[model samples]
Target: MNQTVRPERRVLAQRVTLAHGGGGKAMRDLIEDVFTSVFAPPGMEDQARLMDASLLEPGAELAFTTDSFVVSPMEFPGGDIGTISVCGTVNDLAVGGARPLWLSAAFIIEEGVEITTLRQIAASMQKSALEAGVRIVTGDTKVVGKGSGDGVFVTTAGIGVIPPGRRMLAESVRPGDIALVSGVLGDHGAAILAARGDMDLTSDIRSDCQPLNHLIEAVLTAVPDIRAARDATRGGLASALNEVAYAAGVGIEITEADLPLRQEVRGICEILGLDPLYLANEGTLVLFVPPDQAVSALAAMKSVPAGRGARVIGKAVTAHPGTVIMKTVLGGARIVDMLVGEQLPRIC
Candidate 1:
């Protein structure tokens, strides 16, 4: 990767640069001369002014968040970053009991990346957002010298409104509660892995990257007292349940026999030495509910198209609060902990 220098912009030389990603004069020129001219909306004349990563909206009761997508192959078995960008943010808001309304997308594109790919990605994103009933109200785009940027990087911020009287947060969890998952886990991570050409086992996995807002709505309607909820994305089911336990100061006792695992996913995990519990999933929801409503809640979740496989995976325990234990079918016990680090980075 050859470096480049251009003094006109008065910027230092770029290291390991491609013509598009160069930080030298070409980079500044690209921003000020090309991108700004073509894509910059009137309100966003200066990228610097966008530094705080915020917008002007008074008392929106916003559920604001940011997420970056770096999945190795931009396209995968179930979806590309386009759908991932939309679904991920939608789930984040849905988990918080917010109805996602608006989204802002920022792209860091490598120079020399095909325009065709970009178009397809945008279309996929648009379609996904429409299906989720959200709008892409604003966005930003930048091109780095080819090497500095991967094919592309996407960061999205979502704003959603929480429905009245439907507060969902970890603090609402309590002992004697139950943890329900919307579907079989590990599909998203395995789908991603399969797309990477890791033929550890025959490919039969699909990314669980569907939007969960409908399922969330159903659960809310069925059990307004739902304690807490989370989408199992980067850290898989084990990590998600642990967060609930930690946040609510409750113990989680999960039964291995009750945990849902598709046969294909189970086989792949066995071959890859991957623990399905720690793999990423895009389309699953983890909900905390009062033990009394657990059955109805599971029924409600299973009733949704996206939650057909919903089941009670575990229970909140009074003893050993803040800890998560797994009860094996053989009558043994094991501990489940937070993902100390990335079991698989760039999974989302």
Candidate 2:
């Protein structure tokens, strides 16, 4: 009797293994069935297609940025590594006075990680991209031996369009320009530290991880003469200000009382013996605007949800060029020097 020759059934692997990273059928299946499936819907040009590179419109000035997120705990209050991956790159472009457009993400995943976890991260990235009004057009994935890597690490690169007549840069900052911060400082760093649970500390602080492109656009529209803008990521507000001062060949003076510090963040810093100025922030930005336009700029920033707590913190000056000086509440002034080393590592 000619019995039907049944084809061998292919069983899908339940967990990632070393074979997944190998450039073979197992790796191909992992990419196609896992990462690509999650990031690209059916009929879409999948990132697995591996195009040489994405194309941009000709003759358009572009702002490009890249960042990597390796924050421990993977998940944290208010956001996670996935969300930060998108916001970090988007904010970099926004601070350059550009409108974010496209993003590319790469993942380094450790073997044995739950596929469900990866899916959740992909979903988060999609939601953040929607909110930020950007597209994730390409990506890559690699798996390492279980003990050789962390659960997952994400790196993202972004492209944006620089609007005509908008030229914000550190070198553009001038004496008499006012400095402004988007919101309360050190929330992200404090949140990450608390999330670690190492010190047995508990707090309601959450990472301020959000896209600032819209807020930046609003400020630029209202104050077209903005001199420079920077996101306070690593090294926090102090590092950002010092870099700007050195680049512009000017000094900066900020009033301690004018700084917006949340009570929770302040408490955490005091307890940990850390300075909020040097802590990292994911959603905060520092702006330099002409003194005359400072009021309008502050108002414009406050109009956005991300910048509702915006404040004019300081001003650029000619004396002590290339330095940042902070006026204390005790009627004294102290130099806010650039951080000699990292205070909080992997807080981003």
| Alpha-carbon RMSD of each model | 7.6, 4.9
Clashing pairs in 2: none
lDDT for each residue of candidate 2 in 100-156, tens digit (9 for 90 to 100) = 888889889899987677777887888888999987878777898879888999999
Candidate 2 global TM-score: 0.91
In model 2, where do residues sit more than 4 Å from their true spots? 1-14, 41-59
Model 1: per-residue Cα lDDT over 169-235, one tens digit each: 8978888888889989899888888888756455867788888988899888889998899999988
Q: What is the C-alpha lDDT of each candidate?
A: 0.79, 0.87
Which regions of candidate 1 fall more than 4 Å away from where they truly are?
1-60
Please report, as a residue range, the 10-residue window in candidate 2 with the lowest summed lDDT: 47-56
Model 1: lDDT equals 0.79
- Taking all chains together, the TM-score of candidate 1 against the true structure is 0.84
Q: TM per model?
A: 0.84, 0.91
Cα shift from native, residue 323, model 1 (Å): 0.9
